[model samples]
Target: MTLIYQAGQAQQTGQIVPQLFVSIQQPSQVALNGVSTQRIGIVGTASWGPVNTPVGLSDIAGYRSSFGEKQDGDADMGVAVSVAQLQGANDFRCVRVTDGTDVAATGTLSGVTFTAVYTGTTGNALTVSLSQIGTSSNWQLTTSHAVLGSRAYSGANWSSLQAEVSADGSAFIAVTLPAVAPALATGTVTLSGGTNGGAQTSVQFVGSDDSDARTGMYALRNQGCAIGFIHGLTDTTLAGVIGTFGMSEGIYMIASGPSGDTISNAIALSASVGYKSYGLKMMFGDWLYYDDDTLDTVLISPQSFVAGRLATLAPSESSLNKQIAGIDGSQKAGLVSTGSSKTYSSAELTELFTAGIDVVCNPVPGGSYWAVRGGYNTSLNTQTWGDEYTRLTNYIAESLAGGMGAYIGEPINGTLFGDVRASILGLLSDMRGAGYLDNTGTTVPYTVVCDTSNNPQSRTAIGYLQADVQVEYMGINRFFNINLQGGAGVSVTVSNG
Candidate 1:
């Protein structure tokens, strides 16, 4: 739908004569160029007024950038002109001197020289005179390398020194002397006649590396003062003695031997296998001798050990003799010889009585003389050899004494059983041929060898009979007999010739 406009807001209508008539309209914006007609001003009033423009690039009409222009400093973007530049700004003023007329061509009165005289005391009372030295382009102030001068005292001019300082001069703390330093080439800052000068105590150096580290002699003297560091004492007094003697375990001891006669160990004089020494000259442990040396070593052994050396040679006493004395080994009654005389020293006796058998056994014999007897004696003569023999026969006859009867002796103590039994038998056999009967008797051969069973009853009777027979012939020969009997048993008797 078409809308109608209000009266003042609508467009004005012109004559419709078609002479190409058109109403003109101003553009929404004018297209202008070059400098604009605009006042550059701030938005706030001058003293008290309303604002019109903002002080910024957007409020200005045209602007261009340039690169060459800079601020207050060099091209470097650092802060410029600190407070120090104001120090000497107007520090001095000049009074112009002219010839009372203008000189036309004098370019700003030539040039100017600024001089200020200072009136202060010389800094160091005693100055160090220094000079250049060495091939390098530097200076050295070392005491080891510094050249020394005779006398330097108070009021000495320090101007000739390497560098100057003030009278209250604590400022010159130290001066570095380079390897090529030219100062102190011919002068030195010496110490004299003060707390630390002129016949003063020596200076010392403390250890530098560590507390326990070893240092120079000066360091030891200074640091070890209260430490009581003592040095080892040498024995000069005994030095001569030490020279004469030899050393062992750090001790000087007298030498073991003298001159050319010394040997490392003790030596004995031994004869060579094929050579002999005819009276030797001798030297021992500092002792000298001709032929016989008093200083000789003797070897000895203990008593018990010495006794053991003789053990194999000595012989022991024998107990075999007592055993040979106890028993009868034979029954031939006569004077006869038997056994080894060297072995069985005494005569052995043989006796027989009425109950005697007709045959017997003999081991060794001289021949036949029967040591036999027969008798009847009353009154109970217990001392009767015949009666005792008869009793032995009775026991034998009854076979109560086994088949044989034996008489054995009272044995000596410590006697061996074998020798006692054999000797007793040997004794009785010896009596068989001893002619002990006071009349020679024919030997009755008893071939019956029988066992006497250690029967005490038969052995007593036989032993008694042998004792009586021995007693009866005691005057003829001091012989002993051990009689044995067999009852009525018959056989041929034999002997070892």
Candidate 2:
């Protein structure tokens, strides 16, 4: 019988016995799926749930089930999710932060102890009851909460009761049974002593970048988040931190100043930060006034709305003329709590735009609708200012990075070079077909070089291969002008075919 050897296995040059060897290679052509541009990351304080761990949520209901209801302030993660959902952003990665003083609510009944699964004031609302079931020896354990509703479990003994409740995927409380079963009684007990801890600082929201123990915003690294924001955080000092993270992770971050802030102050704050990055968008302090189910009318930072609007758009599209949903009003326009609506002057807008700041205002270039005034990021260079530039660039770069890894560990030869070029060309063609890369001129929208022309012998001899790619991103229509001539003063020329 012949012996078979797999790829990369060593075999004797001269063997008396017949032998067969097989070398497997990946396909030359690779297919790549574009990464999602709608996953928004949120880092903020919450009343419940794990701290510094990224949790994926689809809707406001999922957010509430994991993080509890919205608190009475801007730092709440549920509040951010609620506002972001208005713009049709359903995919989310949320990370909760705390001040290191939270405590879980607990209560004891007979010999059983029940504790809240998460540490927060919301857990204090949990109530537990035990009673006999219909004259039978089997007992029923019921747990109720204001938001989580009620659940009942029946078992013959304490051990069985714990197993039943645990198997049902309880979200609110954890049940502990005594070693020995006690006489069952009918009574209800409310959990208490749960604390939400102190308010988190800006640094806590930024978190650490340690790979082994990621926290806060860093916890969302490699989580496929395209856009991100820290709910209600207006501190400009940390703008560089978030901007750097966005640039490194390919996440477009949205940040805002305090509500009702002056234009001059906004400009000054941005100048002080001195951060000019294509990955971040800084909003002027025109906080949005939105109606909440529990808080009625509340003023919130514009970061969530901006992030959501961008998330809902295609990578090639801009948020400039898109109307923001769920906005009752804003600090600068419509009905204000303290004063009448204040419209920004043309000069004031110029100053804000010049300083790389954007605002939500009415009378957009299209019409009288609330939209992003300027489609810009914090980039001082005009080339990268438009939101489309940041998003499209990130999208293409990430897609290539994720798909090109298949070529690694393969033989470095002409076939490898052709494979690399083909993979890149395929993705670029798909992007162009999807309307992301376009050029009005006669030239093609993209170019890829992975052949021996760029990869010289000096480099390839040392186990090095390179591929260079360039893409022309579509531009946004920022300005439109029309020239008119009066009928009486101008002479018209008629053309005949």
Candidate 3:
């Protein structure tokens, strides 16, 4: 029998036709019984056969000659399956073939669970219902749209807009949403065109807080609101338009030029409270009873003066010295006090006041009084001289009457030890000589108290007595000379007078 190959095809069988796949087998002399070897368009054919007809079969089993040719010798006889026929059978297809194995559904969103997906040549759109369960159930929508405005950039385009959401909708704050994909250079990118239109609308009932961490609005909704930045009012052409600026409050506006817009009363009110910054100006007010910078035009009652009672004089040499040395006859008293009422700055009047303070007596009528004629500092950290300089300068410059005086001794106790002692003696002597102390040149006992309690350097006790000389000078009858005479005396009388 000649083995052949057959390619199977679906036939209109009353019963379900089982697909047959056949190949040539070895039986050279006789064909398998009850098997119809159908030729499959080629010389090689296939047919149904009994299960055990061709037993002990091999590639070459029977030897015979075909088509009236008797075989005297073998002529390379063997069984072979037609590779082309086998291939055609492999490519066979069944009617109404189910294609559920290899093909996949197109356009699957990787991490999204879409309740419904609409795909078309136009575009693909996914409808995701917020789920209380799966990842598709709960979600945060990220979009690029400006819900709030910014001064830096304008227009409806939200290239810089951001949004966010939370569990609570009422407190739905603004958030920064990622920017949408830019339009392709080709232009006209299609979105899902459906009843939904593929455009996201009220996906969120309300927006959350702003995600712009630098924005003033973000600061307010957050906690401490401040914009430590500068922005331009116009297009960002030149970076020079903006500069480094700061504001404490969340909301602030900068304006320039004298426009019709006046400053809000809130600004002035806040300024009075604390240091606040505006565009170019700053407002400040204090407890000194000032509401605004401008002077109040309203008529108001004058402030009443508060009087100060003088401290009681203690019985001490320094106190006595201070009493006598500080004493100056009134402008109208004694003689027509020949003195310069004209005051001068410490630098200008330093010589006169210094000389008077040193000599302990300046008989120049009204100029003889001791006063703080201010001085200037020659070096750093020595404000004493500067203070004196400023004081004397200001007093002489501003005084209505009397010429300014200088301190008799240095401001510090230890610094002017001898000067202080000598100044006391000289001042008392000058007073006595001028008859301001007494009517004659008799050596009058000027009770001088030496209290060391307030002294910086103490020797014996916190409170103790130290003897100091008290001298008296006289205006001589001859030559009208100012004479300085000294005499030795001891502290003997203690009268508490």
* Poorly placed runs, candidate 1 (over 4 Å): 1-376, 379-415, 436-497
lDDT of 2 by residue, 1-497 (tens): 54455544654466566556555544567788899999999999887888899999998899877888788888788878888898999999999988888999999999789999889988888899999988999999898887767889898878888888888865467888778877778889999999999878888888899999999889989999999988888888888888899989999999889878998898888899986989899999889888888778888998888888998899999999899887778877855446555677889889998999999987677786678989889998999998998898889888988988887787788888888888888888887777777735677888899888999999988888899998877778888778977878788999998
Tens digit of per-residue lDDT, candidate 3, span 1-497: 32246423323346453454345443211111111011111011011111101111111111110111111111101111111111111111000111112121122122222111112211122221111223232233221112111111111222222112223232112222233433112111112332211211111101113454222212222221111111101111111111112122221111111111122332333233322222111101000111111222211100000000001111010110111121222221221144433333345334322221111112333354421222111112222222222222222122211111222222434434444444455444544454434545344746443335434355523433243433222221211457665557644556886
Best by TM-score: 2
TM-score to native of every candidate shown: 0.10, 0.91, 0.12
User: Candidate 1, overall lDDT?
Assistant: 0.20
Give model 1's clash tally.
Answer: 52
lDDT comparison, 2 vs 3, better candidate: 2
Model 1 residue 338 CA deviation (Å) reads 55
Look at candidate 1 and tell me the lDDT of residue 416.
24
Q: Candidate 3 lDDT (Cα, whole model)? A: 0.21
Candidate 1, residues 270-389: lDDT per residue as tens digits?
111111111001111222111111112211111111111111111111111111111122211211233421111112111111111011112223222211111211112324222222
Question: Which regions in candidate 3 have their CA more than 4 angstroms from the true location?
Answer: 1-415, 439-443, 450-497
Q: After superposition, how far is residue 303 of candidate 3 from its true place, in Å?
A: 29
Model 1: lDDT of residue 455? 28
